[model samples]
Every structure is written in structure tokens, then in C-alpha cells.
Target: MSLKSTHFHSGLTTHLIRRGSLTMSYPRDPNPTKETFGVGARWDVPAEKVHEVWVGNEGCEYVIGE
Candidate 1:
């Protein structure tokens, strides 16, 4: 009795939020270098003051209307 096989691919879900994805990877070079994500926004100003700003030199990032 000998059965041992391991080659795997099955974990993809998007816009469905069971693990909501913009593509993530971890299975030894399944292709994903670095694609980070984090954005939060809340603004009507005059509440801690910071109106419009922008900065994205590495890839993309925003926390506008601080």
C-alpha cells in the first residue's frame, strides 16, 4: 500500500469575500512577487485637518483626506 502524490493547485476566490482576493500566492513560485493593499478614506475635512494628498512611488497607496 503506497500512495503518495503531492502537486497542488486549488485556492482562488475573488469578489466573493470568503477570502476576498486581488490575487495572492504562496505555493513555491506560483507567481506573486509583491502586491500589497491597504486603503482607508474618510473625509469632510475640518475634523483633524488634511484635505488632499497623493503619494505612490513604490506601487500605489492612499490615505487621502486625512
Candidate 2:
């Protein structure tokens, strides 16, 4: 049902759902199955184009940049 990945520094387990591919994150809670937490997105970029990558991590996708 999900593709899981581990982040050592964060000590959090990330799972990628196969349906919509939505990413979910947990605070390494002791009870993973019963604990619900926030989520984040992941992307793969080339070294040459790293600077050009942009994401609306804070959920501000509507406000235009002045």
C-alpha cells in the first residue's frame, strides 16, 4: 500500500503512497501506527538545476510574488 523510506538525521519514517503518491512524515513517534503527523514532498533534481527548483512548502501557492 505504501513505499517507505528512512531518514537517519530526522529519525522519521517517510512513506510514499502508491495511489496519489502523497508523502507523509512522522516525528519518529513511539507508536507509528496510532500516531498521525504532517507530511512533506520529495523531488529529484540535477546538480546543474538545483537552484531553479522551487516548492510551496509553507502552503502559499496563491499569493503572487511582488
Pick by lDDT: which candidate is best? 2
Candidate 2: misplaced stretches above 4 Å? 8-19, 23-27, 34-66
> In order, what lDDT does every prediction score?
0.27, 0.28
Worst 10 residues of 2 by lDDT: 45-54
Listed in order, each prediction's TM-score against the native is 0.20, 0.22
Question: How well does candidate 1 score on lDDT at residue 8?
Answer: 29
For model 1, residues 1-66, the per-residue Cα lDDT tens digits are 112222322332222112212222233444534232334322232332212222233333223222
lDDT of 2 by residue, 30-56 (tens): 543322222333333222221111122
- Runs of candidate 1 with Cα error greater than 4 angstroms are 1-11, 15-24, 30-32, 40-66
